[model samples]
Target chain A: MKKLILLSLIILSVFCSCSIKTPEEYYKEKEKGKYTATISINCETAVKYKNSKRKKSEILNNYKVSYNKGDTVFTALKNACKANKIQFEYTGAGDSVYIEGIDYLYEFDCGKHSGWEYSVNGVFPSVGCNAYKLKNGDVIKWLYTCDLGKDIGAVK
Target chain B: MFKNFNPIALFIYFVYVLFISVFSFNPIILTAGILGAVFYCLFTLEKKSVFKLFGFCAFMFLIITLTNPLFSHNGRTVLFFINDNRVTFEALVYGAVLGLAVIEVLIWFKCFSTIFDSERIIFLFGKISPKTALVLSMTLRFIPNFVSNFKSINTTQRLIGSDSRIKRYLNSFSAVITQSLENSVITSDSMKSRGYGLKGRTFYSRFRFSTRDIVFIIISTVLFALSIIGRTDFVFYPSIDAPSLSGFSIIGCFSFSALSLIPFIYELKEGIRWKYSISKI
Candidate 1:
């Protein structure tokens, strides 16, 4: 009888040792956020007709953009142009942005092509005058001539 | 101590141990069941037989653990090297744990077998059918008798002109099989001649539902019901991750099991007293 009691006590102790917490204790920790806006792209028709030299607006006609965001001027310019549905083809030499299908250019070198150019937040410098961050109102122009290539489709 | 050890109680405890070990993954509950079985075995069985059984279990445990890792490679902790093979500590531990559980379950089963011999069967289940009861009793008796008979026949055949061991073994096997068939036929004929299953069979049992038996049955029934309900309804799957044991549950299990042995304890005590009075004469 004593042995039985002792055995029971031991078993009880073993079970009691496993301390399990309730589920309510786990619900107190998590994170919060919100949804943002979408960006699009546009192209000219001259670049579309296999015409290398034509009016920038004639070649690149349709508009499309890819959404992006970063912490620099080039990133901002890229984002604004992306938001405005303008496509960029390669611009000449140093630092410049081009209208993808349209064969129009925006150069930061002041001597060649020109347009409204400003530093994003007047902070971090731009890479090829293309790295820029988006403010409330920033219209980025992409004017260059080449093929806008394929739209490569949209992402959802 | 002997007076307290009841066959019915022992059987109940045996069942409880078996149930917990198999159904409950809580190591503590399993350990308790194992310990209870070991304690019961030590208290009841002869020392030499217990030692022999323990040694056999140890041998089985070693064999199982050594062979288990070759088949199952799981768990995260590595123990040592064997021929450039890293044996995980978890697999080895699991094998040993399983082996111990098997041994503990067997010990409890043996306890039940000892307590519920032919007489107890006749007492408890006699009313079911005389033929069924007789067949069960005879089967239990025949197992050991058949083995001994087979051994003796083999020896005798070898002593006579048998040529090779294989031939002698085959001869002995055939003889035993033929003899067993003849015995069964004769037994069946005798049973039929005696009107073994004619009409309603009346049963004779020394067992009566005393106050003790009634109490024991009630407690056992409740425990069995609770155990079934707990397992089917309350228990969760992947029990390895589930917490299954608690102080109250363990106590409830142990108490129910102990209650079951009351009838057996009464019988043991009665036996002791009868022996004592007979010795006085």
Candidate 2:
């Protein structure tokens, strides 16, 4: 009883938000492997395409990028967007990066079910973009589906 | 427990803890305040009361966590979506932390209410403004008295075979209203009969300050000051870039921890002493 308060106090203070090194520092402290991935925005089948005259080659394509082993899909896609000049809009969630739009094509812009969806190795990741860390030879696709990812063959 | 101390010490201690709970948004400092409150609750309150508080806090925590992600879709990570809006883990975690901080502060107030009863509150405020103190004390007394009266009336009705809960509640409510009206009339009559506010009116106080009280006041005030001075600036949203602890923050954390745990420590020491003395028999 005498030391109960004292012990708990010490534990609480230390466990408190005193410090969690930045992701950069964390990776620097540990050995990291080199990895490469491919990311591209697919919007050829968006509902807007039926009425617009924009060509498929101008809107959809592939991007090859390299990232550190622990780099998330969000980071890789972000870097690829920077390199390729693709417009991207996102919001931050604690661990998940919330993707709202790509190339000015936002969710619900094409239709009620149209939005951005990401798939790794042709499978839609159940987790958020930032939550899915990149791996060697990973294939990431940004699919824009006007029919709830049905147009991009990504929803199922 | 708080009443045993000089009202000065009690007031200073509670104010400091409450301030820290409100201003210190960091998860760790907030957690310490919460742990301090939890310890206070565990030591002073019944198990049922503590559990009830915990259940309420947990429910609040869930609501905050689930709802924050819906409105503020800020974060690099998107967990899921409702319609076109993305729900992020960052917002969820942020809400949970904020919710925990609020719950901890509320529990601290609960502990405050348990320790600083009306008499102590009146004593604390009485010297500054007599009328204010009287009103404050009476307000505190009226609520509990009204509740207890209602309960008793309901029990009597139940004993007389009124089984409908709704009817009993309504009956009790009306009975208390009538009782309050009668009480106000009698109270005014008694006050008028005694010439309460007449010239040469002077009030008597039972409180006596001791050397221990002086020492306690000085210590608590100084420690609370240190805790305030040591508090660091923090921001939570957009990203978590919490600065590492410096000397001042460390001092604040230690002092805050020490200040909040005072009651618990005092009670524990007294319990040990009493047990030891009893064992001699």
Among these predictions, the greatest TM-score belongs to: 2
Q: Give a tens-digit lDDT track for model 1, residues B1-281.
A: 33233345434645654665676544444555556656666767799988887888789879887776544434334344332233455566666666766776777666666566777655544566776767877787787778999999998887787898898888898999899889989988997897776777665555544566456556666766655444421321111233456665656556534533443445567768889999999
User: lDDT of candidate 2 vs native?
Assistant: 0.74
Q: DockQ of candidate 1?
A: 0.01
True contacts kept of each: 0.00, 0.00
**Cand. 1 Cα-lDDT:** 0.51
Tens digit per residue, CA lDDT, model 2, A1-156: 869999999978875734544333322332223777877777776635666443553344666777886788888876776555454567776576778777656677676887788899989977888888777888888887778777777655
Question: Each model's DockQ?
Answer: 0.01, 0.02
Model 1: residues with Cα > 4 Å off, grouped in runs: A1-156, B1-17, B46-48, B80-86, B129-131, B157-163, B218-246, B249-281
DockQ, 0 to 1 scale, candidate 2: 0.02
The candidate scoring highest on lDDT is 2
Off by over 4 Å in 2: A1-156, B162-168, B188-200
lDDT of 2 at B44: 74
All candidates' chain B TM-scores are: 0.71, 0.86
